[model samples]
Target: MKKLTTLRTKVFAAVMLTIATVAATAQTNGSGRLVKQDRDLPGFTEIEAGSAFSIKVSQGDDIKVTVETDDNYLDKIETVVKGDRLHIASMGMKNPSAMRVYIRMPELKTLDISGAARIETDGGITGTTLEIIASGASKVKLDLNVELLNSKVSGASKAEFNGNASVHRSEISGAANLNALNLKTLTTNARVSGAGKASIFARDEITADLSGAGALSYYDNGQLNKISKPGTLTFTPQNPGSGPSEEISASVEATDAGDSTIVKIGDIKVSVREGNPTKITIGGSELEVDDNGNVNFKRKKQTRFDGHWGGFELGVNGYVNKDRQFDMPEGYEFLDLRMEKSVNVKLNFYEQNFNLISNKFGLTTGLGFEWNNYRFDNNVVLLKDGNDLINDNFLYARNYNKSKLVVNYLNLPLLLEYQTNRFSKKNSFHIGAGLQTGLRIGSHTKLVYQDDGRKKKDKDPGDYHINPFKYDLMVRVGWGKLNLHANYSLNTLFKNNRGPELYPFTIGIALVSW
Candidate 1:
């Protein structure tokens, strides 16, 4: 019996020892020999590269990294994390195998890429700023959601951005190309000693200073503010709607008649003496060109159609339910809606028009956000049961003076507009009739009153039986910047039979028209 007990104890000990050894192996070599090291770095803010290697970065909570390389080149890469910045570089240029580095971190404040390196992102990176300095035939590609970006390229390097950005500023020298897409604004100062090019697409505005034989191309809706010496600048306007087809081209040529230069663009021609570069004569108008190569057209009224406009509008809104179709629950009634206190606000991002014939009649469509508020005349409360909105009187409450229902929506408006003079700055009679569709974002009721001599407020957030989708018929008529607007909802305010069948209408004045 004693020998059998001793044998059992020995077997149990051996099993536990084997289990521990397997666990330790998994902790060290689970990802295989491709990953040399995996580590965590807290409070990392930026990344800087020193040499030509591939990198993939992604957004995460705490900074984490995995160094991936071939077995033969595992000892040829190094990663260092310092205060707010992480540095990745090659130990030496002797290794022929390329290294792949993967990084995960929180949103960074800056990303600096320099030297001969290839840096990419696993997904779109959001940050405040981005900087890239490439040399020695290196390449950098980024999918970014950044607010500010600055890039500088020298030697034979190239950089491209595939995501949206708010503002981008860049400088290029040597032979390279910088391509960016969906940029809101772009500013570039380029000097091409050899052969270089910069192309930007879907931009709102472009400001460039070009020198040497380099070229720049842009497709945008906004104006081009340029200072060019001897390079090519091609601009394609972003026209969404059908309009009069027009092509504009300009070129400068040296004339044999003295040291003057002749600038010919379509039917307009200007002659500039070399000694008097600022003075040019176009048609019968004498224009002054600024030192930055900006020509002002204020000397004559230049009438051109601007295809798109964006701005905001604020107005007061009031609803009318004359048919009294709104049905309340057994113990509740809707107080009179206050027309003076109700408000409507819209933020128009883009309004594009296509000319049907000339520019007098057009079709317009755009994207915007609409916020509507309807203030009730009495102190009332709202409750929601499932998808139904139920109204309850202030039975347990007292001294509430104001109660309002607010609804927010994302709206798309399609209209047919007509104007007497399409390209006039003066008063022009304009009228538009349209249909708008809205997707509900949120709905809430706000109540304000005095309780025991202290001001108090209550807010309730829910669907409130408001329709998830709404469509309305709208019309606008006015002169120039001022217009009277009206909207009538075709659908009931609530879901079928869930609440009142109120058809809402708004009459207000829009401050601006596009």
Candidate 2:
């Protein structure tokens, strides 16, 4: 009996040891392992996400919420269902990158995000009416097969949509970007304000209200009713024969042009040529007063259309190597630029236009001066020599606060321009494409650095292997007073075999124009 009790005690000790080891192993593994838990939540018709949590939603017969995250974070995340809305959020978690919530519901009528959370639908959202609201830097991409879609996006958020909807109503403000170009809609009512940008695909009808520096581009032929305030706005249609076919009535604003008084209403204009016997011109028809003061109606003669030039432009300059890539090739890293800081400014001070094809088309010649600043990403200075490679000619020293090369050019451009509505300056759509030739007026290198706790600036004038004369292919397109321009250099930036074969280009917006 003594041996039996001793053996039983030994067996109990071994079992207890094994159990403790297993418990410790599990605790160690659970600390770093991810845990997935499913919460049996009630059915919800709407969903809201906040606090930077990623959410994936799908449609199913029953509602289910499955959360996957670090084992310790499983309890910190919140999934609360109140009435018909399911709210998914994190309480105090600093890093929620690993947290993912998968939601399944029978129907989803609304999806709202009030934080920087990323929400995407696994499949198409099918319903009669669907509303999506996004704010606070959130990103939402959804596929919809709904009858009606109402979306309001603000802040720096972006919303992208695809699929088919009968009607889509969108209001976008701030710096938001709305890309619904693939979401085919029969009718769309859009309001874009601030610096927002929207690309939409509407088939039949579209009503657009625009303000601020916003731009709207639409695909497909849609009859438009547009209202625009006094601001820089761009309306571009992607498809041929798209945009407004009929003009809507608007308040009139009058401006004087020489001896003529031009009254503008929306995109339409009427000109009254004032003199002893006043004459009025409307749409190609003219009402004239003779010397005897007798009223007569006649067909109006073709008039001259003023070209759009003489504007102040601000843009960013970039370089593309011989491989047509923005990245510099090997041994050419010193030529890499701080592209965002490489500013390009232009002042077009003079313009001359010659009419062609009854004032609808013209040839425009303009004189402008361009100031191009190429800020180097590396701390290197350009040397003044036309005989050596850039790598062999530059000096690299201490880290400077600013290192840049400046080039000033006197530009002469010859453009063939066309206008859609020649009668109204505020309503016409104009596009110009032409060649620009430039002569280098000045070139210099500037460096700003600190020396012994004191800021010092140095400027050195140099040829720096830069091309004395350069040519570029330039294109300009705009609606009303808002215009955008791009230029691509045809020749290399530097003399052949002297520096890296870089092609310079610029893209920018016209700030002020006449």
Candidate 3:
């Protein structure tokens, strides 16, 4: 009996020895000295593109993608196609530069995935909708239709979802350029670096609960629904006045960023949700008439816009948020392309510095002609305007300036419009800051002076003598039909101190042909 017990002990010792040997061999890396795949586990046994181990999954079955490529280089991956109900993303990787995937479920409606993996797709689930959720600091390209999509990141993450995007607890570093977006959902705790540019191609909604810092410039695609008040549902960038005594839980740390918020909708609704502390960022319009669908973006931010001097069509136009706003930022005036409500038009916010050096319309000098009809129907200048002089002068009739002239001019402008199409659908933007060249064919000017401070004079200053050969500077924006343009002639129109400068900036409609 002692001998049999001794035999069993030897057998157990032998098995233990074999297991230890196997463990040592498995920990070894790839190619020792040469570059090869990291063969860590059975599932990670092979690391070659096009070589996949897939399990046939039905509606109820779980669909998972597990990758373990530690420290090894994964270059130029084609794609991983997952046709299952549930998708899992578990990857042990370092620098995954370029990797794409196309996923779809033949049975399920929505796919719920968890884990860390960087994937770039056309922005679709089943290659049709843009309902793809990304975890970790992953990059994704979405151009398809997505009903409801959101990406959450726990740590530092960077992902680019070009189409409509909704993020939760993620750090979208740089390289997240949303070209023509319907809406951008920046709730939760997220940080954006630079002033991102978003051209709302349609009437969409923007919910910004920002607590960090970044710049955001929005180009409303359609008729713009401007908001008069600040958002209540959305949080401004957080202010960590002083260091917290204890580590307080926050979705985002404002210390790591510069913040901004931009919301584009038809009018606005700034109301507190019932029985909820969170303020809801909702558009004035409904997403659907029958049922609640995904957020919808209609084109209504811009409308019947034509260059007053150039007669160019109005489209999506604004600064990249990189320039300085001496007077005002770009997109100050919302063009109601939707043309739904009573529209109000004005000059767009512009940085004239760039236009000064540009040869397209800035700096350049040329000659042109235009016929303008200044209609003072909608009191846009009186509606909360930042320019104090503009509000007072718009109300002051040029004929009241005690001059022999009235407010009227046939702008024969010959100004070189040096502009550029930096990045967008339009070719180039006409620099509205160029020194203009023009010949004034019509008449009318109001001359006001402090000499008559005691008694204000109201008389036609120049009804007969028109400002001829009115050559100065001119700058215009927009293309085709909609435009917000202005021109300031370098040479003064009046010969004496009685008349004002050729600074007649008319915010009206000018339809440009070609």
Best by lDDT: 2
Candidate 2 residue-wise lDDT, 1-514, digit = tens: 3463355346434543443343354433224567789998888899998777788988888878999887888888889989999988786664443778998888989889976789998998889999999986689999889999999997667899988898999998766779887787878888887656787876666778787655677754343333435244334443443223332455544445566565656545565555655556666777777577799887654477788876667777777777766656666777777766888998775567898877889999967789999998878676744476453233445778998899999899999999998776678999999999999999999989998999999898988888999999999888887877888999998898877789998877776575
Residues 253-321, candidate 1, lDDT per residue (tens digit)?
886776877878755777666656466555556677766788765344324433322334555554433
- List the candidates' TM-scores in order: 0.45, 0.43, 0.23
Q: How accurate is candidate 3 locally (lDDT)?
A: 0.31
Order of models, best lDDT first: 2, 1, 3
The local lDDT score (0 to 100) that residue 52 gets in candidate 3 is 21
Query: 133-215, model 3: which lDDT tens digit per residue?
Result: 33322333344333444433221223344433333223322223232233333332333332122222222234433222233
Superposition error at 183 for model 3 (Å): 7.1
Query: How do all the candidates rank in terms of TM-score, highest first?
Result: 1, 2, 3
**Which pairs of residues clash in candidate 2, taking residues 3 or more apart in a chain or in different chains?**
none
Q: Which candidate, 1 or 3, has the higher TM-score?
A: 1
lDDT of 2 at 324: 64
